[model samples]
Target: MESLPEETSSSSSTTTSGGGVGCGGAGEKLPIRPPIQPPSEKYSPLDWSAYFDQESDVFIPESENVFHVYTAGKEGPVVFCLHGGGYSGLSFALAARKIKQEARIVAMDLRGHGKSSTENDLDLSIERLCGDVLAVIKTMHGDSPPAILLVGHSMGGAVAVHVAAKKVLPSLAGLIVVDVVEGTAMASLMHMQKLLSNRMQYFPSIEKAIEWSVKGGTLRNIDSARISIPSTVKYDDSKKCYVHRARLMETEQYWRGWYEGLSEKFLSSPVPKILLLAGTDRLDRALTIGQMQGKFQMVLVRHTGHAIQEDVPDEFAITVLNFISRNRIGPNGVEIPGLRRPMQSQQ
Candidate 1:
């Protein structure tokens, strides 16, 4: 569901002590790397204390995407923003725009999604995509540790977990996971595969492409009568047919590996957090098959859907604010029972 991120040329990197998690190849097995010391102090801790002041504004973006990367808020702590599938940093623009009034916000267009690239050639693996996020943060830090917050939704949420677990992100003030779970890596892979198989056939023109895309997909559920076209999707006039502005194919690969799984060592690392689920989620626990073992807090978004931001942004925003107020750090947060729909909800 995401747009494409511009393809980045990777720097040569060999596993080092505390080199963070190993980047697994597509359909390739990854070897474990030993944990290393934090990066240089320049990148060690982010100074979040200053951003709390009101009157933050958007600065020029630091990325090279089709859309501008929004950096807003005052001089204080920084927060990196990650959006859900098929969307871009624009998805968080509205909410984070407000948060900017109090702190700095750096919202990223996930690689291959949202203005990064134009191909729907998606790779839905967790490991690579998660690495993309960390790479961006590292680029921003330039070898400095500054305190910051991460607001990740759905797929973005899973990426957040894997990054935070690495403990390589210095001065991460807090983590806010929006409606994501451990098994998400697996679920996203299946979802993306079906989506790609069904709608990936490209059209000669943009109009025809978007037309066909609209006929299928979660887009049909938009209830056009009430829902506005999400910012994530926009018609590309230059092309006669609609083309996903995001890179669909590479994204697919990132999530594919994710579902296969990331290192278990990270599950315990992301603490001081919150989880927002939708009351409407109907995933079957039995079919999920695996057991959810660990600790984390969970809250249902009253009457929301899988895309909490799109379905009920207000509630989602409120819950996030509450989590920020109640637990910025310290206790990490609560681990709710694994998400599973009851027989009744299914009916």
Candidate 2:
């Protein structure tokens, strides 16, 4: 298995027949015809049960909204995951399958996304999003919460930082923010609408949507896309096609709130934290200063897009497991055996 880099730095062959054939000449060699191949495996949607140990809705107390959650593994420190905008809990399906070997995963669908519902789903302001996460944790774990390692991606990363800053979850063990930086995210907000407008609004089937996601580079891993994309869309009886379950364009007003002040908050949180990014170029001013001060671990995962977890799940899992081991974190906040301490920085 490939290990993390020491520092935070960061093809098809065609075969052709050799013999040339003249027009029915006596010495002409016959052209070789390729034998029939088996039919291609359909890019069918995969069920949540295939990756997650259980799928259920946790009803928030004193509220009509119910959040859908996918849980994996029976034991170990809880790795609570929150998905990015326009994605669902299923986006972490592949990563959960691998990480569950060393830790439990609780990935939840945010309000207005996936199967999760709310009175005003579009109210995705930072405060409301944070409240949703806290509510779910309180309702599920009650007074006694397990040691949780919070992991979030993109918009979810912003939410994770805000949630951690609240310091409400006493058992919160650590934080992992993936491929999101406040400066970069805020700067990209202007172009988000154009990006959203350009996406295909409808698909003939879930398989087609998955295919498009892979081919269009929205998601590079086809297997991950097949399982995750299905949850991102819903069948439209009127249009006779599938449309995005969450209308991302409609939530444009909340985009800025998700990312503003994210870096400072992430650094201020009183917990061991790590920042995983697809490239070092995404680092903003605040993060660069924090990283220089050794405030948190910064990992650059090359060749991945924004969805680093789904793009390279094995690597992502190993990164998380290493984080847990390096921190000596175990189930229920105990020390795990046989885990090595992270190496010291030579520089």
Candidate 3:
């Protein structure tokens, strides 16, 4: 195993510009509108049991927040997934479905997003997010923990880096960071902010929400968007409309320093890591294929955007599986024998 780096200074600030809308794709022009207020009547809690094979909430007593976790597959190495900003655990639902038979998949909705409870303000911090992830790992593994793999996207990728840097999970096998990297450009960050800022807070119907999502250009994969958008919203009894469950303002505030912090954490991580970059040009050029050659593995998924898994589910799953198989360390932190799978050609 690689040794962790020494503790470093806190993250630095970056200049930000605000203009235009949409995450990475172009969309139709919509009328400017104010955000919709929360409903007067309490929201009807979503019953995900019917949608996912296993859906349950794990209460983190330390933070006093209940994290919604969705799991599939009865056995194999545990694969814990963390979704990006404004997304829920269901963001990985499609990919999870494809790899469930090979691994026990667990995806969680971070605090203030999806079905997770946002009861405390402490839940919004990066440290607390790392704590929540550790609690889940400890709870799931119990006395005998197997080699675990962490797969994260965007903001969640930062959280994963922090957790790995902390060295909390003794059974941790590898880290797979999607799209996000150490030196993300300010322009890209500003674009994401504009995209979130321009999003409609509520929709009159689920169909309308899907239509708006498609027109808004937040997601490239229409099928993935259709599944994820509905999962991120809940019907409001009083308003008779669907509203987003994520707290976008709070998330965006923390995202300002997320990249810098992730850089620090990445430098200190001891586990084998894989950085998956979308083949799009919108993301800033920071770390290159030549730079990470021996330190860590990097793969570029051609023609995909920030949401690599959603944009190319099968390819993403195969990439993850290949990485895990290649880096399957045992409980004592030694390489596992006779369990490796043959590598498939990269797409």
Best by TM-score: 2
Q: Please, what is the TM-score per model?
A: 0.58, 0.85, 0.74
- Output the better candidate (1/2) by lDDT: 2
Task: Please give the distance, in angstroms, between residue 313's alpha carbon in candidate 3 and its true position after superposition.
Answer: 1.0
Scored by CA lDDT, what does every candidate get? 0.51, 0.85, 0.69
**Number of backbone clashes in candidate 1:** 86
Tell me the tens digit of each residue's lDDT in model 2 across 145-210: 788899999889899999988777777788999999999888899999999999989898788898
- Let me know the TM-score candidate 3 reaches against the reference structure: 0.74
Candidate RMSDs in Å, in order, are: 23.6, 9.1, 16.0
Clashes of each: 86, 0, 0
Identify the runs in model 3 with alpha carbons over 4 angstroms from their true place: 1-52, 185-187, 190-193, 237-239, 280-286, 289-293, 329-347
Residue pairs that clash (backbone atoms under 3 angstroms), model 3: none
- Which of candidates 2 and 3 is the stronger one according to lDDT? 2
lDDT, candidate 1, residue 27?
36
> TM-score order of candidates, best first?
2, 3, 1
Which parts of model 2 are misplaced by more than 4 Å? 1-40, 334-347
* Best model number under lDDT: 2
Error of 1 at 345 (Å): 56
